[model samples]
Target: MTMRYDPHIPDRELVQLADAELPAVRSSEARVHLENCVTCRARQDELERARERFFSARSEEFAAQVPAVDSSAALLRARMAGLASEREVPGFWSGRHRAALAGLAAILVLAAGVAWWMDGYRRYPLKPDANLTPGATLSVSREQLCSAPEADGLRVIPAALAGEVFHSYGIRGPKPRNYEVDYLITPALGGATDVRNLWPQPYSRGAWNARVKDALEDRLRTLVCRGAIDLYTAQREISTDWIAAYRKYFHTGTPLPEHARFFKDRPWE
Candidate 1:
């Protein structure tokens, strides 16, 4: 039997890898780890793609300001360059002048519904028992459970906490082999190792199980780090609904082979 590689590369390291900022030894180790780990490799790919997308979007905006090669183009270029250099911190959903709110609105709209399967990037079907972390309500900030690895929350929520999580979710009599107690945001992504991020995910159920979500978590972390998406957005997407997130990152409605559909026919039972 093949061993499942669950230990993940830290979120900060993944970002550093994407930015090519790692030192020689660390980079060499990370490369070796990525070569042996399919999930990490996929995450690295997404990070690279996200970085490319971010810069490409910025380039497109700059390209649009080229003044159409007119007679007064020199002055226009100077003005455009001046305009480009001014930086402004963007607020959530404000979309800024460079990005519109259409995508944000779409995520909100799609997040309200649950019928999307094998479709575009959308939230996943949330388990009836899924929940946020304990620290989620302490006014501590959402970044504790939302932003990937910025907090070095690499240690998973201990297994001893599973019973408490299951109890809180009202899942009784679920065998250890039948379900997995997992983090909603996931530790690899800076999700708190507390009750709020914990849930009883069924290994005995459908394609949308812990294994599938594990992949999504890493992918989302990579995207978040690369600025492809915001941390708040990724948190909202996963905590409320992960199926949509899975599709968004994996770009497939169908479950990957790692996720077993053992009881696909009776997911809720």
Candidate 2:
């Protein structure tokens, strides 16, 4: 039997779902609803696209000007806790005061995120953790990856091995739809079926999410097959920083609409 969501999912809940922080049961229900409900899905898309644009603007335009936050993310979180404690007063529970606290807390959280980004924590969630997923590949010729009938961009992650991947990335018991246990170098490009080549890629964290990377992979494969680009260079570019590779190959500062919407199925899913 199918379940339908009444009204739309709340923006906060949608954000939580996108972040892969939603509870397991609810996440499944929300995904079902998202699949069946175009209105709700469009709303979520708006939120994700807006988030991507914000990150792009920050990275390209403002990153140079914004000095790194002095306080570490941990310190900022502590400060937010301190603010909650210190702001207590008679009648401080009023709506206006509560709103103020919420606003300030949000700022602190954003600051903490920015600090994390500055310190290189953004790489893993957006890119792979180099130490954990340095990428591995089979010794196949370009003709194999480019011309073989089996070179379809499908992925096959073993259940037990996938669990190890989540644990290594410190992501325990994640909802399947929320993150793709993706290969850093895809099989279509001769990627190895090894733990070191895999990472749990969130589907909706930022603009350069797993879907965008899939587009780059397809484009790279096409180029390799067409002799427009060499396989080694394509592999090197993708393994290094796929978002940059997307920009270079697609000749766009941000992802194209078609690329963002494309999804290649993983058999394990």
Candidate 3:
């Protein structure tokens, strides 16, 4: 008869290799191997017994080491009193020190207030009465007159004629006339007329003159146009013919003949 080899020998050896934590081997060959492995089966049993003994020893040692907790009111009170005593002694800062601190705080607040006031003064400075005058006349330079764009089509009147016209229009005082001219060149005339039509309306003549005055003041203040030749140097060249035409027809120097006088005091002039 053929003999069947025991496969249990290898399975027993594997259980020993895993320290007795072995999975079941189902094959006949593996069972036969395990059955023949007597040394491996003995090692597996010894490992399992050693593990059980180790766990039982550890459980006893842990039970012995655990401490019992005490709950006495006297101990708790003593601990709280020790903490309170440690905090009771005054350190660097005491009640007298608090007064000094308050004084220092007050000084800081005063300093901040003074600084704020100084900053405000710097931002909004005081001015003299002279600076507040309603109308102040300023000399117009040639460069200013010429700087107006040619496209603006400004009529170039002689300075003398300009003065006369301003006088006729009730812009008598130096201040008012100055203000009037300023108004004319800036927002007034520029806003009202296009390049093609530059004349002021009869009613708005004072306003137009003011605008011109403002323009002249602005140029003078900037120091841009300075001379007589500079006065006529317009970006838009005013033709000599046009100047002559204005001088002849719209002369402010000559009083209009009786039939042409439009208003009672020539208020619009």
Best by lDDT: 2
RMSD of 1: 20.7
Minimum summed lDDT over a 10-residue window in model 1 is located at 116-125
Off by over 4 Å in 1: 1-156, 258-269
By lDDT, highest first, what's the ranking? 2, 1, 3
RMSD of each: 20.7, 15.5, 43.6
Task: Flag regions of model 2 displaced more than 4 Å.
Answer: 1-124, 150-154, 267-269
TM-score of candidate 1 to 2 decimals? 0.42
Candidate 2 TM-score over all chains jointly: 0.58
Better of 2 and 3 by TM-score: 2
Question: Which candidate, 1 or 3, would have the higher TM-score against the true structure?
Answer: 1
- Candidate 2 lDDT by residue in tens digits, 1-269: 89886777888989999878899999999999999999999999999888777766766785467664445655666566656655664564888887777677667766775676555444238888889999999999998776676443454678899889888887756775777788888887888889999888877776878888888888888888899878888878889878778886775789888876778846235
Q: Which candidate's TM-score is highest?
A: 2
